[model samples]
Target: MSLHLRKPSFVLISGLLLSLAFTAISLISYYVANQSLNQHITTNTLPLTSDTIYSEVQRDLLQPVLVSSLMAQDTFVHDWIEEGEQNPEQMQRYLKAIQQRYDAFTAFFVSEYTHKYYHSTGILKQVSDTLPADRWYFHSRKAPEEFNINLDLDTANTSITTLFVNHKVTDEQGKLLGIIGVGLASTTIKELIETYQSRYGRQVYFIDAQGKVTMQGSQFSGASDIHEVKGLQNIAPEILSSPEGSYTYTNDNQTYLIKTRFIPELSWYLIVQHTEQSEARITTTLWINLTISLAVIIIVLLLQHFTLGGYQRRLEYMANTDPLTGASSRHAFEMLFQQILNFAKRQKHPVSTILVDIDHFKTFNDNYGHLLGDTILTNVAKVLTQNLRQADTLCRWGGDEFFIVLPNCHQSNALLIAEKMRQEIEESLQVINDQQLHVTASFGVAEYSNDETTVSLFNRTDLALYRAKSKNRNQVEVATESAFKTV
Candidate 1:
């Protein structure tokens, strides 16, 4: 096939081809060099930046949740409700005790089941919103143990940084008591993520437990609504899902480095993003290199009439093998299987086919997210390649599945290997975004018989796989004799 064709003299055409070849080589080299440099810098800096921001946010967010959880379980609150009477003096004493434990707790406040803000620790006080005769907190006083009674801050006040933890104080039979709540400054959380972003010259945002973007910084502030940014959804649904992973994306004609981690204690997500605006400026210089390459090609074409070279026939054989997995493609596998069949006819040795399907790969994509899915696929491919013998072949069939040709192996041997693969993949945990994803694979094994043809062997293997999947996935099963007999 002609690499290029533009009408020109023989000498010019030959020189042009040579110039084009050199230019291609030069372009490839430059791309490799640039990527390596970028990767080196990113590798050195990204983890430190991600960790710093994550640590800062984690402490701030967890502090509130922990304190709230602790207070909700406090013995004093339970005792007070069981006493069956509201004593203003006793309530003030309990509030003072809690305030001493947490310095951030500037005041201890109470709102009754009727929503009256009547009691305070008297350490620090504030103006209050109107109370309802029967408020949401009244229901919390009777809530089940599993239910978290943190007040939805938006329901109480939009202007203040506040979190309220309410618990049921019941008698032996579960009676309601007055509701207690504490409000704190929201500026504390704002300062937490913002402080780290400022320190590292990075950008950070905090999404609430419900997946809403609650806090964002100046660098990320351009997002009219952070939820509208496609990149955030591209990662896991929760930052805690993948505690640490860094990927690049292009947005609004700009490239960004995104790192995500989850805060389990607070059920919040921390996201750090960096724009590679400076990198884009460096990349623009690549166009200049292309122009210089074109000019050099013109000169070479003038001198040699652009003579060119070509590939050897052996290169076709090389092309058939997968460089990443070192396995044969469908075409090459078929050819090799035919060759094996011929050899077996002369001196018989049984051959088997194993079809392996990775289980819940969609969940991997959904849970840990897609980039990690690719990583899992690669790791699984490597594992399959490692398990096969030199004489056998393993090929990625498509989409979280693989095909293996076990030459000269009995059904027993093939079944044994399949079971091993199933077990290993099941117990394996791949770390992505600081979370561990447990993955598994299922297998169907079919052996070739003297009566079976090449196509029939594959058909039986496929049928066996259908049976395996139907029987509640994640195990290996061999094709029954009846399965191949009809085929």
Candidate 2:
């Protein structure tokens, strides 16, 4: 049976149907676009905010503490305090001398017999005060002698507070002559965060490994509790257990980026957070606004695609590229190594790598100047590129070390490639203005093992390189079977 539908009012029906279809599409597109905008904000902005916060804390607070710790362990300070207690005034003057070395400290003190102490702030306080029962100084003088932190209570008031770090000062006979206390103002850290916030418009927090908030950014009006943010707690456990990590979350429709890094100096975790609203919102809005103003949006995108995109790409290349050597930088090489490892796993092939470091590089640089050394590196790079096949890659792993990745290569092939690279570099010596710059490299080769992870594989190669250097330079050494058997 053939059934045919009647189409008497075709024009009217068609118009009504088309109008409804267009309205539905318009509503759906708007809904989808808005949802995407929200997701984009959540995914992108929060992470950027987290990174900004983390970097700021690291650059400002953690770095200073590290520098201070280095200065604290200086030989000069140790030698100056070697004098006995009979010369108490001399000891006081010695304290003054040490204090004068660094401008970072405000109050400096040495505690000998708990009560008998010598204090000096030659730059700020003219006459040093030896006030007893100083709660702050006494607290700093306590045991667990590694690092003593105490709040200065005597010379320290609410407004002008001081944090003290006391490290034991020992005599030549290894006798404890007292502890050296370095007073750093709490306000200095406060001002640091303030300055960082002013520049980056981000909030910073100095949280310990246990997720306790040590310091909060003055710009932050949020709660002081470390556990205030659920996302932070979840990340804290994993990141504190490991090296560094980041987490993103959304709260009250606002995106937050939280990044945590362990600051080795003060044994603290530096947490940084930023509002990723600008990048996320702008990118999303521009995409949505594209439909509304298609012509203008297209023009803007094209302009960015050509100008800003190209500029950023070029900057990234410069940053991750060795200019003179024409090879990838250490960072870029690591990225490539990971990619190659992944490919090797997927293809079920062996991945072999080598690290070659130039021998006597410093001597060459000192004798012929850095300009000739750079030229030598360039020539070495050219030789490596010329001799090696396209399948293999060479990168500037460090100043004078190059990493070579040979995918799907066995141990025999790997050694051959490493030796050939060494030979090529040695033969590529050039004389720049009567200065003979000869280049020779020591290589460490390693073949991929089924049980080895990517990180461990690199470590093995590094160990081999160390062995090669130890056994005299300008040679190739494969990682010992016993060495990697355990790994």
Candidate 3:
């Protein structure tokens, strides 16, 4: 053969052999991996997800129990029961407060002696053992445990399913006096399941020891009995007998892994489900494989980044920003103060601080009402912010008081800035809630001393502000007036 023909033939043979070898090797590895992954998912992955869901559900359900326990031991409840339940309005108001504060679906107390059921709204009914609706109260009364959590419709109010936590109350001598507790709506539990499902891409439901489906999210059928479910019926008996275990079954020609855990607090089994592992698709070409893998990796990273980043940003904003005055929060200001101080020390620059307190603010708040009081605070902050340099940090140091940090500025310059801010606030005519008003503030300016800490600097400035208020209401004073410096 000629040289060109020989070369072409040799390349064709090499390519065929390479492709065949790769295909054979891939088949063996793929089969092995499928077995291992299925084992791993059944043993580790699905169970871990079940455990996480259990922990989150337990935390939420246990809170109502804790609150019910507190209500049971409350002195007011003890006193009210002993005094023959004289004030129904007071008890109603107390229950209302509990419901509103905790955002519970229902809050109630049933008197053992009188057999009366008092709801947050008013008296719902009188407890009687003969009535089917009041059997829960009786069950709670006879139960050995202090409390029991039940999922059922709240008959007194809307028939929407509610998780009721009924606790027994006792007197000083441990005699039964009443049953007290709160109810949580099913929406909360449903939302919890949906949240986890979105993250883990799994199905979740709850079942009792008797194989009865007690709780389930919107995605699952509201079937009352596990024995009714097509494939689940086969293993239902085995699962109902155990506290925790795993099982697999075929439904619609597809196998699913089920991980079950018993929650003693709610006396319910949490079941998390995952579909059986399938073989991964095989693709030829290293370039194409790399491209697909990179695309998938990017998507997963972006989702994680956004979820975590959004949460972190929200937390930081809430912690560091003042809601009312649009200034940095006290905590945020403290952190910035340390950073500014260190920068000043390194640059050999001056850092001055100013404190502004609205004169007669309490009396004004009392006279004009808190709504107008908040308006004045916000207005004062706006005026001060307008007068400040870009380097300055303003903080709502508390009610009617504002603190400012001026970096790379001397006390004299800070004094000028403070006086300007004070005068502008006094001059600006505010038309608040159809009422005309004028406001004045006392200003205290202090120069940072290297020997001093933040507290020392603040104390000196506060003393100066006190002097300004005592001497003349709408004026500025410097820390130099007190001659106070850190030793």
Among these predictions, the greatest TM-score belongs to 3
Per candidate, the number of residue pairs that clash is 15, 6, 0
Residue clash pairs of candidate 3: none
After superposing candidate 1, which stretches have Cα over 4 Å from the reference? Answer: 1-34, 37-44, 61-76, 105-158, 165-183, 209-211, 218-220, 230-245, 277-487
lDDT of 3: 0.80
Clashes of 3: 0
Whole-model Cα lDDT per candidate?
A: 0.62, 0.62, 0.80
TM-score of 2: 0.39
Model 3, 163-264: lDDT tens per residue? 999999998788999899999888888898887676666789888878888777777754688898789999998887888999988888988888999888
lDDT of 1 by residue, 1-487 (tens): 2333432445565665656665665455456555653563356445545665565554454544556555555555665544443565666765665556565443344444434343443323222344452354545554555233342443334456454444333335555444454444556667665666665556778676556776665556654444467665554354435655667766668767767667654455667776664545546644554565465446444432322222223345446775445566667777777777667656778888899888889988776544467678777877777778998888767667788988889999999899888877776645545777767777899988877788888889988887888888888878988988888
Better of 1 and 3 by lDDT: 3
Candidate closer to the true structure by TM-score (higher is better), 2 or 3? 3
Worst 10 residues of 1 by lDDT: 304-313
> Which runs in model 2 stand beyond 4 Å of their true positions?
1-301
Clashes of 2: 6
Query: Which ranges in model 3 have alpha carbons more than 4 Å from their true place?
Result: 1-29, 32-38, 48-222, 227-244, 249-256, 261-269, 274-302, 367-371, 429-431, 435-437, 450-452, 485-487
